[model samples]
Target: MAGCGANVTLDPVTIPTPLIDPMPMSVAVRIPAEFEDYVHEDEVLGREKWRIDLGRSNAALFSQLFNFMFDEVTILGPDDDASTLAIDALIEPSIDAFEFSVPSQSRTESYAVWIRYRLKVYDSAGDMYANWPLSAYGKSEKFGLTGDEPLKRAAILAMRDAAALMIMNLDKSTAISALKDRPAIAVASAQPAADEPAPREKRSQLPKRREVALPPPGPAAGPAVLSMDPDSDATRERVPEGSSND
Candidate 1:
């Protein structure tokens, strides 16, 4: 977010500047080519409602993550000059969902926002080998906040949380190994090659719920009789109709 607010400021997450390592492979992280319309605007709000550029925010944070993922993470930006980033592997990111809304109109002053994305990985040969999805969220609850304060908070928090999750969980992806090997010479852009990636084997999309058969109903059990406690003194307080003792 260039600026989440016009007046009200949210302490947004700063871009991470970590110690770069000298590993064997150089990686290129491609910024999102385009964002969905909502990524740049939110219709339900006051001033500065449409100012948050969530797509750019994600790309900036994701680039930081790339730094940690490889020895040298070169940002293959959206510009045409990508020839210097001779990378072994490439990471392409795209936004899938972007939304922000107040939790309740009458209660909290804060707002919640989420940004989801589909990540595509390519080997140096320019074949897309793997793809996956991720999501993040942010919230603003500070007092007297205004002018896109909530949106800013949401964007910053989402980026930080998403990066954290990537560090912990992205190892499970199949693309990591492919990203670290097979170097390629830099080109003007990391354009898709004619030889597309092999078709990935996807598991059956069917849900795993089973219909369990219940045994046929037998005879219904007899209702149990309730035995109420009837103390002699307690029973005397109840006057029977038409036989009440005056």
Candidate 2:
């Protein structure tokens, strides 16, 4: 708090429509109150105080991103309840951590931002199906005397990085596409005649929701290389040679 301070506010971000077929699923996304008005404050080398406000940017980004990814999307506010809605699946997104580095601290001409995001998927019965954590990074070179512009650009780029990663890997990681039309199928098979008992095989027909093991609470590895194009050679190069056990 002793040195110069910078306050950076981000505008809502938009992602380019991905050139892929949308999943045939109707989904709901719940945006929490904290995700709508997120702010990060930190001191750099005990000299500079930085305050970054991401007001409604995360909510806006996810809203648009999901709309393009799924056939039908319903946006839910913090107070909204998903149990009343009929959908194939429900998704909740939250920020796990945010970090940045200034040129002075890194001894470089670039400003870097790192964002860790968590996505939780649930079936119609509200059972958690998948929980995935992704890290995105962005870097922007100093363009002017002040660091505000570069920092904002870096934050925006990090968001774009997240969008790209989700577009490319969401279904592969979470198997969300498999939930398409599953709710309707489940409802029809769950009910039985009042006089007759349900058959034992009917219960087995329902999709089983398994718990996803989360990594231990700690810092994850540094953000992977940033790429705006998920199909680009650079992005593909990052993929492991063999199939992932994940």
Candidate 3:
């Protein structure tokens, strides 16, 4: 409803309290200013203009969701520093991309929304530990809804889909639980002892540590499928083959 465009402003989203045990780690989540006030505008089929303002819904969603997922959750503002805080890990979540299709574009009675989110985790030492990307999709049919309501519902459902994916795969994907009470890496001494011989230079040195890449989550196909496929690009939703939209 913004000046000849279909405008949808979302309310703060809420998810059902999960029944799973929380991770036994104290963590801090820093919500960036941009993430809190995300907005998306696009024209569908070169005809209709649409604007979707998420406002503070993303901030509220993550704040509520993380409290349920972790034993202790400390929410931080954009300018607040986390270095002084005693935390096992720090997580920063951001939207990589957002896309949606209306009935006119898809030639169906459904509104589909796709959201791609990236999570960056840092250990107590503030070193980057893990980077995970997840994609979530939601579709709402235009049964009885009108005036951008279906699109709004679809967007909210996509957020709920994201919450569910995070609940199930957060630890599995990022291994954040392993950072519980993990100590920071100690700094090496500036100078070696005089009694010790100088270190020898090597032509090629092996890395001190290597990370194991976890496989992406299992495949799912549906209008409301939640995907954790790291290989998926942000170009568009990966609709199932042979589907009406495809």
Candidate 4:
């Protein structure tokens, strides 16, 4: 509670045109529950800025970016409006890190933000069918000494960079494609992928059982009769006439 009192705010991020065609589906963007109690803490030169509210800014920018990139989608908020739409899936974005460096000898003033997210798709049984992780970061630097304005601009830049990264990676993401293709596999959700799925249980239909009769026990076995020993006293295994017996 003992620190500089000021407002660190953010404006909307400009959504970039997706590099690839956005998948056609209804997606709902949200902030994860784990962050419900989170509060942004900032410390600049021994003075602290307490309880910088970032929840609203983050949620809003993410919603705007996703809506611009994808087809039918909803930017969900805490106001309880998602119930009105038949969403095919939901996406949650979490701020993993938000750091800033004030003007100093070690380096110029800069800001960086990292974002991690999850896309959850459900099956017909209302069970989660697929879940995948997506993460990105944004950064900005200012050489001159500026008030909180530079910090605000840097944050916006970081969020914008994160959205751009999502757009670029969306085309190459196998998880997104899997959900688009079948969207009915009910398996446990997975961790962050390397643009590809990890080792998993392969799914395939069981081979059909066919009822076929065995070929009549194939010709009855015949007794072996030793041949080519009529004149010899010892009947050692006489190698068959044409077979080599090395």
Runs off by more than 4 Å, candidate 1? 1-12, 15-24, 35-39, 45-49, 79-86, 103-106, 182-246
Give all TM-scores, in the order shown.
Answer: 0.58, 0.74, 0.75, 0.58
Q: Cα deviation in Å at residue 176, candidate 2?
A: 0.7
TM-score, cand. 4 vs. native: 0.58
Task: For candidate 2, write residues 35-143 as lDDT tens digits.
Answer: 8788998877777888899747777888888888888888877666667666898888889888787777777787767787888777776766666788876667786
Note the Cα lDDT for every prediction shown: 0.47, 0.67, 0.68, 0.45
lDDT of model 1 at position 214: 12
CA shift at 189, candidate 2, in angstroms?
27
Tens-place lDDT per residue, model 4, 117-210, is 4454443234455555554444445545366665565455545555555555543542444554344565445653567653333212111111
The pairs that clash in candidate 2 are none
State model 2's lDDT.
Answer: 0.67
In model 4, residue pairs whose N, Cα or C atoms come closer than 3 Å (at least 3 residues apart or on different chains), thus clashing, are none
Candidate 3, which segments miss by more than 4 Å at Cα?
1-4, 184-246
Across residues 116-182, which tens digit of lDDT does each residue of candidate 1 receive?
6666666666655566676655555656665556557655665555564454445465435545656
- For each of the candidates, the C-alpha root-mean-square deviation to the true structure, in angstroms, is 23.5, 11.9, 12.2, 29.4
Write out the backbone clash pairs for model 1.
Answer: none
lDDT leaderboard ranking: 3, 2, 1, 4
- lDDT for 165 in candidate 4 is 50
